[model samples]
Each structure stands twice: as structure tokens, then as C-alpha cells.
Target chain A: MKKIFLILTISLVFVFLSGFNEVVASATSNFSISIVSETPVETTVIFRGKAQSRSYVTLLKDAQIVAVTQADPNANFEISLTGLSAGIYSFGLWADDTAGRRTSTYFFNISITEGVTTIISGIFLSPTIAIDQAEVRQGDILNILGQSAPSAQVSVFINSGEEIVKTTGADNDGAWLYKFDTTSVDLGDYSTRVRASKESEISDFSPTASFKVSKKSVKSKKKCPAKGDLNNDCKVNLFDFSIAAYWWKKSLPKKIKKRVDRKLYRDGKINLRDFSVMAYYWTG
Target chain B: MRISDLKFKLVFSFLFCILFFVFFSGNILAAHLYFKVPENLVGVGQIIPVNVFLDTGGEDINALEIGVDYSRDLLKLKDWSDGNSVVNLWMERPGSDADKLIFSGLIPGGYNGKRGLLVTLNFETLKEGRAGVSLLDSSEMLLSDGAGTPAKLSINDFWFYVKEGASKLESDKKKDSDSPEDFKPEIDRDDSVFDGKYFLIFATQDKDSGVDYYEVKEGEGGFERAESPYLIRNQRKKQEIEVRAVDKDGNERASLISFVPVYPFWNGGIIIAVIMILLLISSGVYIFKKKN
Candidate 1:
């Protein structure tokens, strides 16, 4: 009986160690990758990346939705945009799960050269994040849920006066949840951001989601928000840059030109000098 | 050999190597812009093909601003090729007045390569004597690291003997047997652009001669030679849009767009829907008053 007890204790220790190793291994395996094609042959481009299985990924150019695709069961996805002129373009992409939860959009600038097909690869979808309550009572639990790559570790950063951090892990289906006890928190506004890391790859930070910690718990959904709002869409992003790009090198009336110059650069032309101002005021 | 003789030989070798490095390293070490011209001399009146190239050494770069000075008296700038250039986009399209030319461009991402082609410039040799092409010191390169850091650079001016007997430069005359490579055109609209009007974007490259111009045609309209971002005369989306890309050699490739059109609100569907809603509201009010 003594020998049997000792054997059982050793096996339990071994099993616990195995689980701990899996966590550590996952933490170390995740990586970040960003690479460009050696030769951009064609004006047409196809973007490939990973998102949650059966989720949808969207491509935005100049602030308009250009294309969207659903990921396969394995979470692999590809989105293509063709008929591009040989020029510089700003593109933004995001992924959405079935629950209407969304990842932060990733923005990039690419110069299209006509001839060869340009392939942009290895993009990892950012994690999705949502809170259970928009106005959580100061002493209640603030529940956060999201989706990410399978078996990834999730870090939640809550900002009040200072920053409070919490950690959780995703299940095999890429779903993660965290419960934060709001006790000892001040009765003020709070913003939360999330990031995910998995074996050999890490995702971008999710967009900021803001809420108030006041007297009662209330449930709501809203995304935290850009400066070059050229379209008056309340967001300054690639979409605005494109609006300017369309007028590139084209002649404008003297009075209108001068007004634009006065507002941005007085160069009286839609040129790089004016673009510099846009870059400076960029909110994204 | 004696110890003194052996020591002298080693010291002499080391000094020679240091001298060579100090004097000749710019050609091999620093990032540089170079021109590939045909041989050392060419006949006057002939087309002098000059291809500009860049070597970034090993650094990734995103932007380049260049200024070129040529012997205006001996050579006149002629046609150029749009194909075979590695430039992603040009901030200032390449142009020349008299003897000086300037251009600037940015790559979306950084470029790091051993030999990247910039442009092919064709200049017609004039009176003949000697001609030269030089890179101005004002030219610069910017690093790709978000921050626009200046790169270490070197330049070499090229000189070629121009002989008197060369014949007139002939044009392939935008005349290639093949049209520009097949390409598609895209339509885009933005409220802040053209006061919320629809416009078109298009581009194409010919492998042999190069693209020269583009023409866009809206429904029931004649094709007009135009640039990208051209405003569409018709916004109704009622007819197919056709775009043509013409090559330097006079070959043309065309793309057409045809899709189902949506009727305007005045076309009557929305009018009837609005009438029904308004009638229902009046009936509801009458019923509510009777019930009260």
C-alpha cells in the first residue's frame, strides 16, 4: 500500500508538469512576421492571411469596403483586389466573428506596379474583444470576451488612473473570456485593450473599447474611434488619403486652391507639401 | 631572409592595401546611382539609350529624389519607356526643360536589392562632339524605417564621345505588334472627391514598347483621351463603360464594364412605397380617433 501511494503521487506530479510545459511552450512559440514581395509584377494583388474559422475578413480602400471573404474551417483566408492603377494606395483590413465581434483593422500602404501579380502574405488577424457591461458598478465583475488563434494567451489591459492587467487563455475554438472584479477601482471612465499570442505567432492589439465604471452595470456595444476626416466620416484614415490622391496633379480653380492651401499648405496645389500636413494630422 | 627584410615586406603590403581602400572604396562600398550607356562613343543624330540604375548596398530604402544634368548642346531628350522600371509610383513624373531634369518618388515599402532599374531614357545626339550625363549632388535617398533618414550615397558622372556621322533617331513610333498587356479598369467614388461624383482609375504596361496614353468612354459617348481619376459624364450607371490603354508603339488594349443598373427614386418604386406608408398613417390615425 505504501509503494502504491508513492507511485500515484509521482504520476500526478508528472501530469501537472506536462500541462505546465504546454503553457510555457505556447508562450515562447508565438512570433511576429512582416515581409514584402521581392518583385511586384502586377497591379492586381491578392492578400492571404489567417482569421477565425468561418469568420469574415474585410478589405477597405480609401475607407470603402472593397472585398470580403470567409475563412475556411482551418482559419485560412485570401482576399483579392484587381484593376488597380499603378500608384500608391492605402488599404485597411479586419476580421469579424459570427457574434458580430470584430478585430482591429490593420492598415498598410502599398505601391502597385503593373506587370506581375503582387502577393501579400502572412497577415495574422487581430483578436476580437467585447465587454459584458458598458457601465459596470464599481464593485461588480466586468466580463470581457474575445476570439483569437487557438490556444493563444490573452492579455487584457484596463486603464483607469493607472493600468490594471489580467491574463487568460483561448480554447481550441479560439474563444477566450476574462472576468475582472472592479472593486477598488475609482468611479471614473475606463478603456480596455487586448492582445493575443500563440505558438510561433502573435496578433496585433485589438482596438480600444471604452466604458464607464459608475453606480450600475449596463450592457452596450460601441467601438472606440481618426484626424484627416476629409470625407467628414469622423475618421481620418486611408480613405481620406485616397480622396486627396484622386485630385493628384489636377488643376483646381484659383479660389478653391487658395482655400485648400490656407487650410493645409498654401502651395496652391494638391502635392506632397499638402500630403505632409495630412500625414501630420493623421489620427490612425 | 633576414628578420628586417621579412618585416619590411609585411609593412609594405599593409600600407598598399590601406591606400587602395582609402582611394577606391566609393565605387564598391557606398550606395550609388549609375547609368548604362552603349559603349564609349556614339554617332550624332542616333538614339542614345541610357538606362538608370541604383544599388542600395544593403540598406532598405523607400524614397528617392533625383536631378539629372546633361549636355543640352549635344543631346536632346527624346522618348522614354514606361515598362521595365522598378518605381512603384512617381511623385513628380520624369520631365526635362533644356538640360536639367528632376523627379522624385516613394516606394510603398522599402526596397533592398543589388541592382534595381529606375528608368530608361532615350536621348537624341545633336551636333556631336562629346556629351555627358551627371547626377546632381542635391539628389537624395531616404531610409524605409518610418523615419526619413538620409542615406550615405555616391555618384559618378558619365561622359561619352559623340561622333558626327550618326543617322537620325527613328521611332518604333509607339508601334509594337502587340497591344499593351491586357488590363482591367476600376471605378471608385468618394464624397470628398469631385464633389461626390464617380471617377475611374486605370493603368497598363507593354512589355516591348511601353504605354503612352489612356482613353475612357462612358455610355453613348465618344472615347476621350484622359488620365486616371477622370470624372464620368454619366452617373446613372445605365450603360457599359469602356477604357482603352494605348502603347507607345500605337497598339491598344481595351477593357469594358457592364452591370445591372439601379433605377433612380424618381423611376417610381420608391414613390409608391412612400404613398402606401402615408396612407397607412392616415388610416391608423382615423382608427385611433374612433377607438378613443
Candidate 2:
């Protein structure tokens, strides 16, 4: 009986000591993982230190392993996951040693989306976008309107055989119009495509529109000015010289011609050639 | 009154209403100035010719005035408003004439208070990277009909970005000038190891404030804080200074080591030759000493 009690006591004490050691070992062996998202895009998580032993890592989303990688003991390791959607997501990590001993769990939150929140919904379809003009001269404002869903994002795509213009968001109720400074666009037929997307989705392309442009610049022949063609009278004789002399002395009848001569010839020489053109015109 | 007279009056009134509807509806359905060229991403030193278009409801406007508000540190102004179309030639800083701008213009022949006109501005870049160009407030004014007093119009301003790089036009021309066979993309591996190359650091939470000076580390080929804050550069392509935080005591924190690989021109042939020479000299000396 005495031997039995002594043996039982020793066994109980030994078991308690072993249990305490095991608890300590398990606490030290455990590890926790977490994820942190600092930007709009969910970046891949990176690990800096090496695992203590050869192990395999498993990335878990809601306790489900979405990705896995093997790592060497005492060797640096890294694995990347394409970030989550445009909302908060919890992620955890666990590493299993060769013997299948697992690590403690970790967690982190991520938000992946642009900060600009746009409200969309009200959209009115129009029969056709009314351009301010059916035909416009170069540098003329090509006003456009028809009907738009109020507060929609409207942009005009000017098809000048190339992308000639792009625009910012327009106020539909106030200024939902796009202007084409025809100076940038060559004289030709153009089909301007208006696109209004509701939620920044690429699939949204507005119905196309077409318009014609007329060149305002006078399509005149490039003629050289003869010296005595005072009124550009087309002759180099005394008559031309008389006109030039008059303009040179004081002022001429046509303001544009006077200004041109004053600009081109400041000294007002008014030589024989001017007189010859003026004389020829005067005679005719 | 006779029936014929009453009928005639009704007909006239109906025609008047129809005409009124046509004119009023036309007036309401007008277009206005929406935006400009270089919607975004303009290059530094590159001339950006912006064409301004107006959306006047079949009317004309005369005389438009434009203004600018920008940072001289980042952008430089050249010339503007050539009297035809509004033109602003901008250059980026650190090179020459780099600056930001606000542009506006006027048109003739429309209701002065509501009509819009287009102004085309050509800008030149001064540097590389991103910056903002906006239309300043109270920068646009329109004239009234009969060319009288001009009324202040509500101008919708815009912000566009600029990215200055080697001129694409020049680059394309260069490509045409140089045959493809003459163009070599190989990296030269014969340069010195330490070619007096320095580092550039950038830290900006937002693009508006721009980047200030970078924190640096000390050494020949190690990290360092940038001497000039505010003027930051992206050094991802080169050997850059790894930044570490400083405490109140001016001591560095035990930070993670950063490693970047850079292969500059030079160092290849010299490294191999130096190794070969050392080996040969060592062997010759060994043979001589043994024989003695």
C-alpha cells in the first residue's frame, strides 16, 4: 500500500510538470498574422524574416486558404495576393511545419476603391444632340444641345480622324456643352461622338452625332504685291504711286490699306513704281 | 363680329404662339463652353497648343479675357494672348520657364452675358512629372450685345495634369533620322563602380502639396536624407538612399535594410582585368620564391 501511494504521488507530480512544460512550449510556438491595407489598391503582403523551420504558408480569407507557398527554415520568405474588392476584407495567415504543427491566426482589414463617390440614376434620352449650329466657320462656337439625362457625365469625342479633343465633367442643367475650336481641326467632314457614362463604366458610350464645318478664312490665291499697286491696283505705274503718296502723306480712304502700307513701309518712300501702278489704274 | 373675322383672329393668335414656341425652345436648347485641350498629363517644356471652343446657342460673342494662377516654382510662363486665340506657352522649372496657368477667352456675335468662345493656348514644358493647370476664378468675362458693357460670366474652371518628357515630336523625328540598325539598346557595362552618382528621395501623401526633401543615410553607396526637401525625385531606377527615422536624440532607429540592384555603365572590363592581373602576379611571385 505504501509503495503504491508513493508511486502514484510521483506519477501525478511528473504528469503535472510535463503538462506545464508542454503548455509553455505551445505558447512559444504559436504565431499570429494580420494584413494591413494602406492604399486604394490591395497590395501583396510581404514577410521579412525566415521561418524557424521548413514550412508551408497558407493565406486564409475567412478561414479559407486562398493561396499557399513553401518556405525554407531560417530563410526570408514573401508571397503576394492580388488585393480584394472595393470593400473591407479580413485575411489570416498560418504556417505548418514539416511535422504539421500550425501557427496562430492573424487578421487585417483592407479597403480598395477610389475616394470620389458619384451619384447616378436620372438620365433623359434625347432624339438628337442639337449643336448650336448646323454649319460653323472656323473659330465659331458650335453650340450643341438636344436632351441629356440631367446631371449625367457628358463628354464629346471629336472624331477629327484622330482624338482632337477631350473634356471635363459638364453641368447638364447649366453648361453641358462641348466646344470645338475648329482651328485645331482641319477643314473636313467630322463625326462628333458624344459619350455620357453613368458610373464611370467603360461600356457607356453615347449615341454618335455628325456635323459639317465651313472654313471662315478666305480661300484666296497667294499673290505677291507689285511695288506700285498702291490699292493693290495690279499695275506698277504713277497712279499706284499717287495712292501710296497720299496714304504716306496723311491717311488713305480704306483704313485696312492705309494700315497695311503704314505697317509694311514705315518711311513712306512712294517711289516711281507706286506712281506707275496708280497712273495705270487712273488711266484705265 | 362676323364668323370670318373671329376665325381670322384665332388663326393669327395660333401662328403667333407657334412662332413663340419655336424661338423660346431654340433659346433654351443652347450649348456653352465645356472644357479645353490638355485635359490631363501635359509634358514639361513641351508646347501644348490648346484650342478653346465655345458653345453659344447660335449666337456670337466678342472679346474674351483669360487669367492664370500657378506656382512659379514648378512652372514658368512664356507668352500669351496673341489677339487671335488665347495662347499660353508654359515651361517647367529646374530647366527654364516652367509654371502653371489659368486660361480663358471671349467671342463676338452672341448674347454677351451667355455666349462662350474658344481660346487655343500653346504651352511648353520645363521639366518632367505631374503638376496641375487650372482656370482661375473671375478670369473669364463676356461682352454685352451692341459691343457694350461686359458682364462677368460663370466660368467653369478645370484642372489638368502635365507630364514633361523628352519631346515626343523630337523623338519621332530622331527615330526617322536614325536608322533602326544604328539604334543600340544594350547597356554599357564598362563604367566605374562609384561614378559620383547621388540619390533623390520623394515623400508626398498628396500630389497637390508636392514632394518635400527626402530623409537620407550617410555613406559612399548607402542611404541618406535628401538635402533639399520639397524637390523630390523618384529613384526607383537607380541606387537610392534608404531613409531611416531620427529620434529626438538624433540617433537612428533600427530600421529594415533596403536593397536595390543597379547596373551602371562601366566596371565590367576593369573588374575582370583586375582579378586576372592579381592572380597572375600572385602565381609568378609564388614560383619565383619557391625556386629561390
Candidate 3:
């Protein structure tokens, strides 16, 4: 009986050791991309681009909507703004996918002169993604979902100890899904992101999703407010913006670490991406 | 050399001069920079209203730096206005130095439109002569691309006459009688600025005469002249604060915030930080004494 008791105590200690329960630092999404293209042309300027299929794309001048167009089934679009006076113009493109989700606004500062058709090409909208489960048990399926340019190739990248990548295609509605099996994934932390590519153009990565490979699954909770709602008030406003502003450009120190949601962004420091995410989910 | 050859050379030289001036001169006004005043003639004892404007010749620009040169003997800068200016953020507001007024600013998203109002200057006329006002040749407009590229531009110098017998000040009938636009002031506390003290930051614009200055009032204290990012004297943060933006025309716009809560006494973070600093200093002194 004495020998059995000592054995049981040793077994309990071994099972509870720190090495067997390693923790992976959760990731926060970071993505703010700005691209500029110049077209040397006369009065008439042509903008050609690809967006989510059947999505509405609008042109903005100095934050004011000037024109709008709907993408074709092939995700191709062209907007010709005529009767334009000769001068400088700050032009931008904003999109709404079939599901009515808005993409990040892309701006182009261009100079217009008189003469030929100046075609500004290669505008590919970035993809928006989300995950169904916050955490999954080993050997279970994690479903990733999002919308992209219609029929475009979608690449999902899962990063554990080793990076696993797979490709799928968006349907005509611009919706794509990838079911990821976590059986082979080590029992550690994981981050996954996606990107979309068309004929010759590829977009930047989507918001990074973070989860853990644990013994039990945790369904994504909608009760929680959107990212950047630091006060748990279910609203993102100037109060939350100020909290992030205090950490601007500072490499988050361990003492003040993880005060923000991991899904907000984890660039080496707080930057425009963190602000962009706040703007994306702003309640006011 | 033959007489025929001399004639040919003279004719060629004349034609070349004409062509050069015509072609380049046509392009000279691509980005028109000029000054607009109430009139060319201003009385010696009156104020001269100077408004600077820029037409970007169709190029989108995001940054600008301008320095003005004027005759110190003829004009003295009485005041300046940033009202309704194209610049969204000013690195340096118009600062007067000797005979020059310099300013630098940025338009975050960028601006690409004609006749963008850059700034307004009110000069007190001193002498009766031509007040030749012009921008320094070093001034520049950078393209809006992520990369700061120089945009092609043409600089135009302006001259206005100040006559001795000129009549009353045109500004007496100033059109910018309207008050400044509404704005909100923010309240914040930061460890970096003012050593964790609370402060207020605020701004606004006047479409006509422009904003001249700001005033801040704390609790019941009399209003005092202040600038943005002002340090709060009441660190306890238990006071009502009001900020007012006064335009060049003396029109004022005020925003008020209710009482702000005092910093909590239970903030153990502050106590621990003070203790950590004290411990480090004591430890250093002890090591030095032991070494000695």
C-alpha cells in the first residue's frame, strides 16, 4: 500500500508538469495596405479593376462618393468618369460584396490632363475572412469562411510549428471555404490567414485568426463584441481609440502586454493596421 | 565670315529665343501659385488682406512647405489665419521671423483640386510703395504617392501697391462675419506627456477669415490663451473644462465637457512603479558604498 501511494503521487506530478502544457501566444491581426497608381492622360480617365463578383464598387473623391459600378460575374469592372475638368483628383475605390460586407477603401491620387485614355489597372480587393470555432480539439475540423473575387483562387495558410497551405476557389458569389483538419497539428498555438489571387494579380492577406489545439472544442462566441471594443461596452468609439493611441508605435512591453484583444493586431508595434481594424468595426 | 552668314546666325538666334519662351512659358502656369488681396492699393495706415492660393495643374500632392518674403519696410505681419486651409495637419503654423513667414503642413489623404486656399495673411501697411510678396524658391509640393515625389510646378510672384492717399481699410467691410465651425475637444491622460497628467486637445476652422488662436478655461478659472495638447493644471481631473476657438474676425466657437473623474487612489500600478524606482536607486547607492 505504501509503494502504491508513492507511485500515484509521482504520476500526478508528471501529468501536471509545465512542459506537457505549453502555451502559445495568441496572435492579433495586422493588415493595412495602401497602393497608388498614376495615369498620365488627358481629360478622360479609366479605372479597371477586380472585386468580389457582383459587388458594388464606388469611386470617392476627397471622401465623397462620385461614381459607382457593379462588378461582372467574372469579377471584372471598369469605371469611366467623363466630363471631368482638367486638374488633380484624389480618387478612391470602395466595395460591397454580395453579402453586403464592405472591404477596405483603396485610394489613388492621380493627375489628369488632356488627350488619350489613361487606364489605371490592377486593382484587386483584399479578401475578408472569419473562423467558425475559436478553439478545436485535436483531430476535429476547423471551418474557415470568407468572400473574395469571384472564381478566384483562395489560399489558406495555417501556421503551427510548420506552415500548412491549401488552395480553393470562390464560387460566382465570391464565397469560399476551407475545412482544416487539426489531427496532425501539434497541441500548441496556431494562426491562420487567407489571400485571394486572380489571373495576374494577388491581394494582400486577410485578418489573422488565432486558436488553440486543446482537448475540447470552443465554439466561436457571438456574445462578445467586435474587435477593438476594449471597454466591453459593445461599442467602439473615441474611448477605445484613445486606449490604442497610447500604445502607438511602442513595441508592447511584457508588463503591459495583451491588454488589447489578440485578434486586434500584433504587428511588432501598434500601427495603422490596429487603427484600421477599429475603423472597420466602429460603432459611431 | 561672309555677310550672308552673319544675317543667317542673327535670324536663327532670334527665332530660338522666341520659341524657347513660348513653349516653356505655356507650361509655366501649370501649377499656378498666386496671391489675392482686397485690392492692389491699400492706405499706408490700413491693413492689407493677403490670401494665398494654389492650383495643382492636375497633380495630386500631399505635402507642402512655403516661406514668404516681403519688404520689412513696407509691410508688417499683423496676424495670420489657418481657416479653411487645404492642409489637414500643420507641422509648423505660420511663424513670423524677421521678414519671413514660414509654414509646413500635410494633407493625410491628399488633395487634388484647383484654387485650394493655402493660407491667409493680414499685413499692416507701413510705407507707400510696391509690397512685392513672393514664395522662396526652396518651397516644394510633394506628390501623394507613398513615396514622396516632387511634383512639377510653376511659381508666381505677386506685387500689390500701397499708395499714400489710399482710402480706408477694406477689412472694415470684411465678408467673413460668420463664426467658426463647430468642433469637439478631447480629454486624455498619458504617461509620456506631462508625466501622466491630464490634458485637452482641440481644433476647428473658419471658412472665411480663418482661426487665429485658442483659449482654454479650467473649472472657474478665468480663460487663458492656450494651444492644443495643453497640460492640465488640475491633475486631480475633477473639474469642468471648456475650449474656445476664436477666428481671425473675432468670432468664437466654444465646446464644453462635464466634470472629469479624479485619478483613482486604488491605482496600485502607480504605487508599485514608484517603489520600483526607489528600490533601484537605493540598491545603486549601497553598491557604490560597499565598493568604496
The window of 10 residues in a row where model 3 chain B has the poorest summed lDDT is B20-29
Interface C-alpha root-mean-square deviation, candidates in order: 15.6, 37.9, 24.8
Note each model's CA RMSD in angstroms: 14.3, 33.9, 23.0
TM-score of 2: 0.21
CAPRI quality of model 3: incorrect
- lDDT for B288 in candidate 1 is 100
Q: For model 3, which pairs clash?
A: A28-A262, A42-A113, A42-A114, A42-A115, A87-B58, A88-B58
Best-fitting candidate, measured by DockQ? 1
Displacement of the residue B242 alpha carbon in candidate 2, Å? 66
lDDT accuracy of residue A122 in candidate 1: 71
Runs in model 2 deviating more than 4 A are: A1-284, B1-35, B81-118, B127-130, B147-152, B164-292
Native interface contact recovery, all models: 0.05, 0.00, 0.00
Better of 1 and 2 by TM-score: 1
* Model 2 agreement with the true structure over B1-292: per-residue lDDT tens digits: 9996676567656655655455354345433444555446655666654444555443333333445454444455444322112111111111123233443222211222222223334456566545444556544433323222333344455555566553353322111111010000111111111122222222111111111223554333455453322121333333323454332223332223233435443544567888889999999999999999
Prediction 3: B-chain TM-score: 0.74
